[model samples]
Target: MEHDESLRFEVLGPLRATLGQSELDLGFPQQRALLALLLVRAGRPVPAGEIVAALWPEGAPASAMNIVRRYVGSLRRLLEPGLPPRAPGRRLSRGADGYRLETAEDEVDLLRFRGLTRRAKREAATGRPEPALRHFVEALDQWRGPVAAGIPSPARDHAVFAEIERELVRTTVMAADAALLCGTPEHVLPHLGRAARLDPLNESLHARNVLALAACGRQAEALAAYESVRRLLVRELGVAPGAELTAAHTRVLRQEVRSAPRKRDLARPAQLPPEPKQFTGRQAELDSLRTAADSSAVLLTGMPGIGKTTLAVRWAHEAAERYPDGQLHMNLRGFDPLNAPLTAEAALRFLLPVLGVPGHRLPSGPDALAGLYRTLLSGRRMLLLLDDAFDTEQVRALLPASPGCLTLITSRRGLSGLVAAGARPLPLDLPSTADALAVLARHIGRERPAADPAAAQEIVAHCGRLPLALAVVAARAASHPGLPLAAVAAELRRSQGSLDALGDVRTAFAASYRHLPDDAARLLRLLSVGCGPDLTADAAAALADLSVRAARRLLDELADAHLVDESAPGRYTAHALLRVFAAELDRRP
Candidate 1:
């Protein structure tokens, strides 16, 4: 947080003292702007006219140099309160050409980050992925926020620093990819996930996720990762999955080779799928998915009915075109109690033929089938969408070794093991306020009684912005045209009487709850007995008759289920519908 140290400044966040770590309170706007300009031109001299132009883009005072000198003098005095008496010619000198902000290379974090990234890139180019990843991670760790957070300058050089920040992200991703290639997907997943989240729109990260996932034996999960990326690209940018991603997906589904025979040859082209009928919010979640997709594979993970399947389906449809060979979609009923989760062998038995492998020739053992699957995809491009994966074992049997393929996997579990194998983790939650309202408007029509702007807002808010709840409320409103939004909101507020009226309304929350561990399920039901805005770890623990640590762990588990939202760092809250669902579950059995 310290901004004052040496002459060099770090502008990634709020302009802070990077040199001495001594905070210099530059009171005036002009003074802050002036320091920003110099920081951009660190280790170099900036001409006086350039400084004037930077400060005053349109015009400058005739005595700009004098004014500039005065500001510089003030900065020097402020920065160096008690300097040693100048030797012969050392009195903050100015010459005919321009003024210089004298500083060492070590004075700036930006400079340090850039230096490290550059080294990492060089190492990667030389095939030293391990060292490269290390340097890249070290450089990225220096960033606290956006580049030049509170400072803005009209100078072109300032823009260069902005680009550098972006490049830093690119470099960080490259380093993480290198680490994955160097044989440690698990080690790099956290770093890759963090970087991808920061830059969700980047396609390269999504591809990286696919690679990582396959490498870690989560092929089905890898396919799900691809679907998530495709959805984000379509929803956020209205763009289809790029050729690279489609080809990668194809490679995975077809079990393509790790490296293509012709290194420079692009994957075969594919056709894009139709766009979704209604797309609302989920900007942040989409970004997170995109980030995960940047890896070789990702697990689109969350509790049931939190739209994991919707997101996966949407992404698959959008990304279909990328895999010209074909888009292979499958669901492994890992969580269905009536039918046991499909084994790797059985799932492959169904998928291999869709991928063009003959049933008569398919391998018998899970490992053999997976090997054949990879062999089939070695040289081609394909996309695979694996939904409702049960565990790492089932998913691992389906992964292809080809780096050219993309895979997207969805699961209720956290699946950190998939992450260890380089699968990006795209965690899902409830819809945002805007998205929830849109869902209601879609289901009930914009002119419904509950569709009044204020009422609609209250309905969505009361529904906790959960998609299922929004859909149900909208359905109810549509069925009863004259029902007031206030009435629906009030009905939702009453837990005991709401369930029967809800009927199948509780289905989504029930599905999510069904997946929870016994202890977590018990705790969720217990916590539902309380009524409040949010629950801190302590409160939740007390409700569940657990110690704080145990309670916190349980709350986090609930969060993974998408039944509880982590409202703050250690605070949790259930959606209105989820609360009702839990209360009903508590009364059951």
Candidate 2:
């Protein structure tokens, strides 16, 4: 409601700005184009020359500067109604070489859309489906039509249009994924359907649509959707539908349904796996989890190999005795390389049997299974550990609608979605130097590290104090006790330029990197070339040749993925080994 009074700028559908209950007239076509350009580069200065080029791509007259100045004055007056004729413009300040539109983050719809999407992504990663679902829906709803519509310029050209459209399709697909996880795939069908019509060649959307259709029990419609995509791909690109779509079609053809078991058949399940032998550090995080023992859900998240699962299991093992009934554990495998994440239906199928319900008597659909799972857990005191979750939707379906139970989740993502659903988040960080040394000692022996303190410290620091990396180094040291601690440290330094020699570190880091979109991945590779131990957002922008705002957004994304650290705002640093890995990736042709 507060946003209603603030100035609202729209670019997804049209070029329009409004204040409160009235629409502000933004002037003629060229004038609107000028406004659109400024809005696109909001919070940053746009040089007069750049503006002139964008306004008239064919050519610009000698009076372009004068025309741009006049347009700026008019926009300033419209944006800040109280400003005097000659008074320095408050909203649109004139810089030495350009003008900048100073506006709040939420004033522009595009900015709001990005903010919402980032939050939704964090939530999904954190395993809070309800809020992730809400945020994704809100973010996707911002796209009314083509970006910068009705503007005549490069802004409306296919090149610019493609970028915005790609982002829109990506968001739509992600929202649909969340919906499916929340047992409401039907809600995203219409949006996905419209997107599929616009992007006929996007096999990913088509595959998801088929899955959604099948999930909703419309097997015929699902097959038809597949056929439609197959025909379109063949006609437009002279190729068949890809494997993902083909698999969806195959699944629909073999669809089978089941029903939930009677309450009498419900069984108490204790299925927690073994905790890591060398679990170290995380005293603070473990304490936080202990404090939230009464909370219905607690989500533990961090970057890949930060030991999210280790901490979750450690805490679960510590708390196992409190829940007398039993414990339930499942690895959702959200980031599995060979297999896609387990769906809510599949998860329930695995879980129901553990809870005493036989496979034959389990519910036929995800929604039904979720309902039955909740019904069975209503009054039971139990522990549910949902590990390696892909997003909030998958976690949501698996949550018991019970106050007496506690659900613990581990993920490589932040999972901001869980916060709205009353999940307490415990983001795990790399271990302290002391903890890393202790872990090494646990693996080998404290005698070697204790004999030479400085060399031992250097070894852990080179590993970035990450438990997994430290474990690898420790294992190597254990295999050759004759080798000095400094030798291992020297090996890490010598191999800093290459990641392959680091052992499965490549596989661990690549799993997280492979999930990023093309641009994000490219930016990371670029950062690897330009980066030192640490760099500010401005440095990143200069290295990548992107606008400051754009670089900052990308940096924030990298930080969220745990590829970089933003311990100090605006400054980013990557782990020593991660930087090497990124650099190695960029070197590939």
Best by lDDT: 2
lDDT of each: 0.68, 0.80
> What C-alpha lDDT does candidate 2 achieve relative to the native structure?
0.80
What does candidate 1's lDDT look like per residue over 163-196, in tens digits? 7656756765676566454444555565556656
The runs of at least 3 residues in candidate 2 whose Cα sits more than 4 Å from the true structure, single-residue gaps closed, are: 1-264
- Per-residue lDDT tens digits for candidate 2, residues 203-289, read 889887887887677878888888888888889889987787787677667663222343456676778889778777779888899
Instruction: Give the C-alpha miss distance for residue 93 in model 2, angstroms.
Output: 66
Error of 2 at 206 (Å): 35
Q: What TM-score should be assigned to candidate 1?
A: 0.50
How far is 448's C-alpha from truth in model 2 (Å)?
A: 1.9
Looking at model 2, which ten-residue stretch has the lowest summed lDDT?
256-265
Clashing pairs for model 2 are: 122-416, 123-416, 123-417, 126-415, 128-418, 129-392, 258-364
